[model samples]
Target: MFKKLKDGVNSLKKKVEEKTGIKEEEIRPEEIPETQETDEKPIDKDSDVKDKKTSFKNKAKKFIKERKVILSEDDVEDPISDFKFDLIENDVAFDVAEKIGEDVKKDLVGQEIKWREDVGKIVNESLRNSILNIFTSEFEFNRYIKETDKPVVIIFVGTNGVGKTTTIAKMAKMLRDKDYKTVLANGDTFRAGAMEQIEKHGEKLDLKVIKHQEGSDPAAVIYDAVEFAQANNYDIVLGDTAGRMHTDVNLMDQIKKIKRVVDPNLVFFVDEAVAGSDAVERAREFDEAVDIDASILTKIDADVSGGAAISISYATKNPIIFVGTGQSYDDLRKFDPEWFVEEIVG
Candidate 1:
């Protein structure tokens, strides 16, 4: 996982080391004093003082030059520029890549380093810090659910073919494992078989699903589900909305209506991680419309670059609640940014 991103960062570090010439180890003076000399030629008393002074000066200059190497902005400019291109090629959003490059450049410039290994270590750590800063919010979904009020309503929204529906089913299974009394609500009335898809999951999970006929009011469907949960003491309600792109004004309006009616405790924006920057843009649009509480990314196990996860969290300033790693109902895992950083940076 994240193999491509790791390789790109490692390559950038190597370039920085090469461009700055920090890999060379300087020879030390071996504690030689002005009076010490190994030369076989006899030292002439008249010129001995002058010769020793000149040798000491040369040693002092070499020691200072080697020990106090400082990297300048111009030294790292080309390497950082190349890193930005690598990021964009690996599906990082152009704006995000630019921001990350500038941050790394700032962190590296004018930094003092000892000769030998410090240069590479500084560059690598700086890149790691830059990426870690992108994951601003650290969230744990199960912890939040355990503390929040019962009968919590969570609406899931995303564009088409992004696995929004399956994600809801996985979430239902996850809640069941936690021993929460959960119910599924099918608000995706526009899709021809959307109702059936969620219904099938309900049957498999042995949970009740509230639904209205296709083309019926979706908001009412979720509202009814919430009411049922309240009456039955269900712990949570996971609502599925019709998948629609940001460009689809009508569907976007309908989604907004669902949020308004349900007043869900949380709104989760689901997207496939493979979509990369496309997913980042979509996440921003969805959050703006409905004010999403968190984000859920699917197909993470198959993602190569892993830029979408970083970009989405940075773009929305919202925590990444979960990521779908596999096809099984139990494959959903809480998103941990620290673990992600370790995998991508180490």
Candidate 2:
């Protein structure tokens, strides 16, 4: 995954080396002394070592004085422009791409490149820090739920065909494996097989499922599930909602009503990582309507550009809690900013 983004970063490294005319070996001050010949007549070994150290220090000072430490704006203009274009072409939002470019430029330009500091390394660190800044909110999902009150209500919301139901099942299994008594609430009564799908998953996991008949009020189903959880002392209540388009006013209003009735502890917006820019916009729309607590991106293993994962959290100002990597219940992995940056830039 993210092959294009990784390749772009590699290209940027080359650009940094080319523009600065500074090789990795040239940046190391220690390597210079090895090339110098030993004195023909060494009076004392300790004195010779001291003299060599002094000579190396003087050479380092002179090298530092002669080399340009600060990069000019014009020197990095072309590389930054190319990077921004690559991000946009890889499905990053336009504003997000611009912000990334601006951040890289701000950190790179006029910065002192010290001894043993490669320009490529500096550029990579600048980009990493800029991307890390976007992930302001980070939390451990399992730990948070464990600490929260019993019968923690969580609602899953997203547009159609984003694997909302399947993601909910995966989460239920995860909580169950953690020894939390979980219950699945089939609140997606508007969909044809939503109840059965969740029910089957519940049966496999040996967890109870709360539901109403088809065409029943979704909020009532959640309310009953919450009530059951409270009565039974269940650890979590995972509610599955019907997939509805964000632009549909009537369906969006239904979700708002569900929120009021259940007052869930967390509302997770599900999306497909492969959906690219469309997923980012949809998440924004849902967040504007009902204010999601976090997000879950499915099909992450299949996504190549990985722009949706990079852009959605920053755009929505919400952290991505987990990403679905495969079809198994254990495929869900918590989002880690450091891991993501390393994968893209290493």
Candidate 3:
């Protein structure tokens, strides 16, 4: 997935190795046998400790508590700066890249590298931590669903062609498996086939879709859906709104009015992972317009740079509840920060 990031980290490791022939211990454990005396004497008590650093081949190598090589900021400053540029070139937002760089630099500068530990391990591990820190939230949608009040209302908002409708359908399937009685609400009345698109998904999933005729009030549609959920004891209501650009003031105001009318428990900002920084900016704007509860990023499997996935949560200050990995209903997975980092670095 993050082939670019992986390669960049690898390149940085090699550069650090080449730039500063910093120091490897000449006294390896294998050279010192258990009972046999070797010509290589132990570090002289009278000699300068800085003159000799020891490395060992023993499986339990952490016994030595001494810091052999201390990394200076100058040693990694240029290499880490180049890596930050690589992150930006890969579609990661500039602010996010800066944060990652600063975190990595702060972590690596003056750090201790133990004996038998190569610079590559220390460098890559630091990079991994810096990248993972950008994903600040560990929000779980399943917990929210299980604990939140029944008939919970979630309104999905985003620009057109970002898979908002399909994502709603996917979420409905997920809720149904959990034995939650769910209903689909078509709040999008602007587009010509908007009603049919959601209806088709509703029919396939065997869920009821509530809607109004074309050019009707969107807020009214979702209001009616909420009413229906209350009467029928539905566990949740998934409402789909007409996709519109952030520049469209009227449409943005329409969403605001719907939020006011329904007072949805959650507002989901849906967009594609492939949209990169553009998706992050859109999520920010949407969050400003209507406070977002979480985000759902589609086409994650197709995204190579991982910019949207890395930047959206940090930008919006809202958790990414789910990521659409593929086209199937089963492809939706809860966002896990640890797992995502592993996928990239492991």
Candidate 4:
């Protein structure tokens, strides 16, 4: 994919260089010297140096005018299909990519066009529609805290190594900043380093984190965490569950048990944007195991195209509550559908 982008840029550079008889770097209109025309004597009145320069400039402009990010008609029966395939190759799920492309096509059909100047606008609008399809809206945080009689419980679930713990910390920070007293439930008691990592994050954020020893029952941990929150009158409770493979029945059953105990208001399927199609597959598995209230897409900064962000939201019909753009606690942000759509198509 990187190679393809580089090849495209190089090809354009070559085309410009061949026509202008100047290096690609020197072709910049602002960088070119103004006195080069006067420095040389005119050779022919009919077809002189000025004429050659004008011809080259025209050729260069024509080449640039034809530049396209999408494929030509000869490349495939459906350019949209080809573009969707490219998106899947960028880590977007096949179904999701297809849906996005179809949505774009639907939005574009029967649109009035006066001139070719609208081509970019049409493509941008199409891609924007595709992105809008993927973005899930976040829950109203203030409403959740203020309206609920019981402490709002948020359970973070995903396959191992998807930054569930880090995301919990970030959310806790957000809650604290909002002046809501938040508690962290260290439900991930299986891995050796899990407790310590979550504990450190809790310490850094200056929030209370409840944890048990290694090999402890995860369900019990969550139950006790809820009890602690209730007793202490915590505004919110965030649980960090043990990372388990979606295929693990024992783990899934345990999660179901925990869900019964806490009955959380929100169950977030935390995923990395780099996972793309795999993220969708994992999300389906997790949703089947437990009711995923919403989604939280992590590692957005790591993804250049962000196909996973679009795919998960579109696939599950679950709102994306937050996006983790970096490893820092401050990188967490609420999902914005409009901005996301504009960025994708543009």
lDDT of each: 0.85, 0.86, 0.82, 0.72
lDDT of 3 by residue, 1-346 (tens): 6677667767788777544443334555445446532234445656655233322322223323343557788888899889889888777889888998899889888887665568887877887898677777667788888899888999999999898998999999989988999999999999999988898888899999999999999999999999999999999999999999987899899999999999999999999988988998899999999999889999988887777778897898778878898888788888887887777666
- The local lDDT score (0 to 100) that residue 235 gets in candidate 3 is 92
Q: What C-alpha lDDT, on a 0 to 100 scale, does residue 243 get in candidate 2?
A: 95
| Candidate 1 local lDDT, 120-173, one digit each (tens) | 678878878888888888766778799998898999999997888889999999
lDDT of 2 by residue, 1-346 (tens): 8888888888887887666655543446555555444333344657978665555444454455565456789768999899998888888899888998999999988987755567778889999998888888886787889799888999999999898888988898888888999889999999898878888998888989999999999999999999999999998999999999999999999999999999999999999999999999999999998899999999989988878887998888999989999988889998998988998877
Please identify model 4 stretches exceeding 4 Å from their true place.
Answer: 1-77, 134-138
- Descending-lDDT candidate ranking: 2, 1, 3, 4
lDDT of 4 by residue, 240-298 (tens): 89888888998889898888887888798998877777888888888888879788888
At residue 69, give the lDDT of candidate 3.
56
The TM-scores of all predictions, comma-separated, are 0.86, 0.86, 0.85, 0.76
Model 2: residues >4 Å from true position, as ranges? 24-69, 114-117
